[model samples]
Target: MSYFLSKLVRFNRSSVVGAVGIVSVGSTLLFSDDDTRFRTFVTARLPLPSQDASLLTLAVPNDLFPPHLPSFGQHGILSLSSYRVGPGSSSDISKEASGAVHDGSKPCGCFGRDTIANAAAKVGPAVVNISIPQDFYGVTTGRSIGSGTIIDKDGTILTCAHVVVDFHGSRSSSKGKIEVTLQDGRTFEGKVVNADMHSDIAVVKINSETPLPDAKLGNSSRLRPGDWVIAMGCPLSLQNTVTAGIVSCVDRKSSDLGFSGLPREYLQTDCAINVGNSGGPLVNMDGEIVGVNIMKVLSADGLGFSVPINSVCKIIEHFKKSGRVIRPWLGLRMLDLNEMIIAQLKKKDASFPNVSKGILVPMVTPGSPGDRAGFCPGDVVIQFDGKPVESMKEI
Candidate 1:
C-alpha cells in the first residue's frame, strides 16, 4: 500500500496552489523531497509512464494471438469415441453426448460430468475391510477393523500399519493373521509383508482364486484445492460407504496439529472419515487413488487427513528394497528463509550469516544426530540429496 510521487508542477511564481502529479497504488501516501505533495490511492492504480513525455495515458497491448475456437465444445482429454458399429449403420444419437445419460439406461461413460460416479465405481471394489484380531496373553480378544485398498490385481493391499497393529500388544502386526474382506463379499486371509511404522503404511499380500479389482494410483503432487475427490471406505463397518468432498489442502503439516511420530506432512480434505475409514483410498475424479485416508479430527466435522499416495509408494519401494522404512532425522530446528526473515536475523546479530535462499538453521541440539553430523547453528541447507530445497516444508 504505497504511492510514488513522479513530477511536480509549481504554481505561477512559487504559489501555494501547485498541481502535483502523484502516483498512488494503495492507501499509502507519497510525498515529494520537500514534503509538499501527498496523495492516497484507494481502488485506482497509478498508470505507468509512457515513452512520450507529453502523453499521460496508458498503452494497451494488441492480442497477437486471439482465440479462434469455440469456448464450449468437446474437450480433447475427454472426447467421445467416433468409431461406428458398421459402415452403413445409423449413428447412435442417445450415446453421442456422454454428459446427458443417467443410470439404469445405457451408460454414456462420460468423463466430464459423471467423474464422481465413475471414481466411486472404480475405487469401491478395490476398498476392503481390514480386520486385525487382537491377541492378549495367549487369549483371543476383540479385533480392530479398518479399511484397505487393493493396489494390485494379485491381492496386494495398501493400508495403514496402525490398522493391523494392536495398540496394546508389543508384537508386530505381521505376527498376527489379518483378514481382508473385499467389497464383493469375498474374504481372504492376508499376510503382512512389511509395515513401516514411521509412515504408517503397510503392505499385505493375499492368495486369491482370480484377479481382484484394483485401483489406479494418481499423482498426489498434482492435486490442488477445490479438486473433487471421493473417500471410499467402510466407516463404522458400513460397507461401500462413499463420501464426496473437495481437497481443502494438499500439504498439511502433522507438527501443526501437535501430532508426534507421524509422517511430516499429510493431505488434508473435507471428506467424512470415521474410525473404520483408516487406510481407505481417497479417490480422485479420474478414478485414481491419490491418497490414503488415515485420520480425522474427532471434535470437528469435515477435518480429514490422508497420506499421499506418492509418499506411500516411496515407502513401499523402501519396503521392497530394505524391508523397512529408514527415516533419518536430524535434531535441528530450522525456519524457512525469506527476505523478511533475513532482516530479522540481521537485527539480532550483524554476522547472522548472509543467506538469500534455503532453510535457516536456528538451533542444533547438542549430542544429537545433527550435532554428530557436523551441522552448525547458523548454517543454511540449500539442498538435500543433491536437489535444491527452498522451504523447510518442502524439504
Candidate 2:
C-alpha cells in the first residue's frame, strides 16, 4: 500500500475531477485533462523484481504524468518526473469557469471558454521543451524537462533561471548540454545567453535553420484580477500543452511568497501549471504574451505565480546591450510598514516609530554599501534620493 501510495496524486482544490482510480506498484495510472486521451510514456527508476530497471517505462491513458512529487508543487504538479509533482488530473477549467463558449473574448460573455484555442493557435508554436543535464548515480543525462518561450526571430528563448542555470540549487555550470524541442517536433541545440537570479529569468539561443515563430509581447501593466489568460507549456513532457485560467492577483508581492529579497510584482493565476510548464508563456485573449509561468504555492490549490512580461522585457533588453542585468543593491533587510506591523512593533517596544508611512529597516549588512553610508538597523527610511519612499521600488 505504501508503494502504491508513493504514486499518489496531489490534487488541487479548484481543479475538477472527472474520474478517480488506483494503480498498483509496478502497474500504470492513467491521466488526462480532456476526453480525447493520448498515450503517455512514463519512465521511472523503480525497485521492481527486475533489479536492473534503471528506468521503468509505461503506457498510460493520457500522454501526461501528474506531478505528484514534492518539488515544484502546490495544488498543481511540477510537471517533472517525481520532481515537482504536477497537480491531480481533472476536467477542463474553461468549460467549468465559463458557462458558455466564447464567440469572442468579451468580458461579459464567456470568461475562459474558446480563448484557449485562439491563444494556442498564436503562441503555441513558440512553446519549447527545455532538457537540461541530470545526474542519475553520477551518470549525466538530459531528461529533466522544463518549458520555454521563443520570443525572437533569431531564436531567442525566454525561460526561468532555475531551468538552465545552477539547476536544483546544484550551482554547477559544467553540465552536459541544453536541448530545445519545439511543437513542430524539431529539436535544436540551445545555449544559455544570460540568466538573472534576481528576477528568476533567463535567456537562451537556438541555432535554427530559418526564422522561427515567436510570441508577441503584451503589456502586463494592464493585467487585472479576473482577466482570462492561458498558460502554454510542455508539462509532464507533454509538448505544447495548454491550460486555462484567470488572473487571481495582478500584483502579488514577492515577500508574501516567502522570498528573501526586495518585493517584486508577480501575477497570481489559477492556471493548471505543472512541473514542465516552468518558463512557458501566459497569454491573454489577444494572443499576446503577458507573463512567464514561474512557480506555484505548495499545498494549495489554484495558486500559481508568473513573472510579469513587462519585467521580462526589461531584463531581455538589458541582456541585449550589456549581456547581463544591472541591479542596484542595498545591504539591508527591510519590510513595508503597514498598520498591523506598526501596531505589532509598538507592542514589542513602546518606543517604536510612531510614523506609519515608510520602510522598516530591520537589519543592515555589516560592510555593504548601506553600512558605509551610515545606515543602521531598526531605522525607518522615509526618503531615498530626495523622494519620500514607502516600498523598496521607491529606493
Candidate 3:
C-alpha cells in the first residue's frame, strides 16, 4: 500500500484495506512511521522475476511497538505505482511469509474477543421483552412495549413501574390490569403485583413454564463512569438486542422521571436506548445486571436513564409486604412567601401570622394528623419532626 494510504489506515485501526505495491529486482523496501503493522494488501507487477519467492521486508525498529495484533493467516502485500507495472493496472497476489502480530499493551482487551462473546451469550437470555396493554379512553387501543429482567425461577419479572402504570380516564379505572410479554414471544397476563411510583419500579408475576431464566443481578452501587457496560433490552420491542457503550454517568439526578416530590436518583447512560427499551437491564462487562432501564426525554437522543438495581430490589421487597411505598407526609399545602407576601408580613405585628412560614393551613381535616399536631389556622409550623420546613411541596 502507498504511504499515504497506510497513513489513513493508521487512524482507523479497525479497518482492513486492499491495494497493490511493486516488487523490484533491486531491493525495494518501505517502512511505517513507527514500525506498526499498517495493513495487508494484494498486488502484481514485480520488479524481479514474478516467481522469485523473495520476501519484501518493511523496516521497523526492534525496540518499537505496534498498536494491535495484525490479522492472522490473512496478511498479504500488493504492488503499487512502479516503472515495471503498467499504469492503473494491478494483479492479485498472496504471500507465504507471515506478518508479526502486535500485542499493543495491557488493559486493551483486543485479545479478549472470545471472552466478551461468551459473556454476552450467557447474559442475553435473562433480558426479557415486555408488552403491557395501555388503556386509553374506554378501549384498549394499543400496547406499551418495554423490557424486564427475570428475577426468580418461579417467574417474578422486575421492570420499571412506569412501563405498566394504568392511565385510566378517571381515578376509578386507573386500576386497569396489565399484561407482560416474555423474551420468547410468549404473552402472559400479569397484574401490578407491586408498584412504587416514587422509585418507578414494578414487579409482575407469570406462571413458570419450566424453570425461569433468572438474571445475575449485580451491585450498581459500585458503578462508575467509563466502565464498559452492555444494555440488553427489547428496544422498540426487538427482543434480546444488545448495545455496548461506556457508563456515561452514575448517580445522576438530572434525568429522573419519577414523581417530582421524591428524591429521585438515577444512572445516566449514553447507550442507544429508544422507545420500548425502558425497563431493561444494564449489565457491566462482568455480565452482571446493574441497573433497571427506566426513562428518556423524547426530545433528547442518546440520553437514557435507569434506576439503580439495588434500589429496585429494595423497593420490590418493600412492596411485597407493605402493598404500597411508604413515604413521609406532612399533609399541608403551603403558599410561598414571595415579595408581596413578605411585605404584608412586615406590616403586621412582630409575631407574623402562620402564613408567613408554614403551610397556610387552608382547611384541615376534622380529626386528621394536622389537627392533632396542633396544625390549625394562624399557626406557622417552622419544622417537621425536627427537619427544617419548606412549602408543603417538600412534604
TM-score of each: 0.57, 0.62, 0.60
The residue-by-residue lDDT of candidate 2 on 180-294, one tens digit each, is: 9987888998887777655668888898789998878988987777888888887767786778889999998755653333456799999887667778889887678999887
Which parts of model 1 have CA positions greater than 4 angstroms off? 1-113, 167-175, 260-263, 331-395
Q: Which lDDT values do the candidates have, in the order given?
A: 0.60, 0.63, 0.51
Q: Is candidate 1 or candidate 3 better by TM-score?
A: 3
Candidate 2 lDDT for residue 115: 47
Per TM-score, the best of the predicted structures is 2
lDDT agreement of model 2 with the native: 0.63
Instruction: Report the lDDT tens digits of candidate 3 across residue range 221-302.
Output: 7777766666777755557667766677887752133222335577878776655566778876555788887654433445
lDDT of 1: 0.60
For each candidate, how many residue pairs have backbone atoms clashing (under 3 Å)? 0, 17, 10
Taking the tens digit of each residue's C-alpha lDDT, what string does model 1 give over 244-306? 888898998755654322236788898876656778889877668999887665334677778
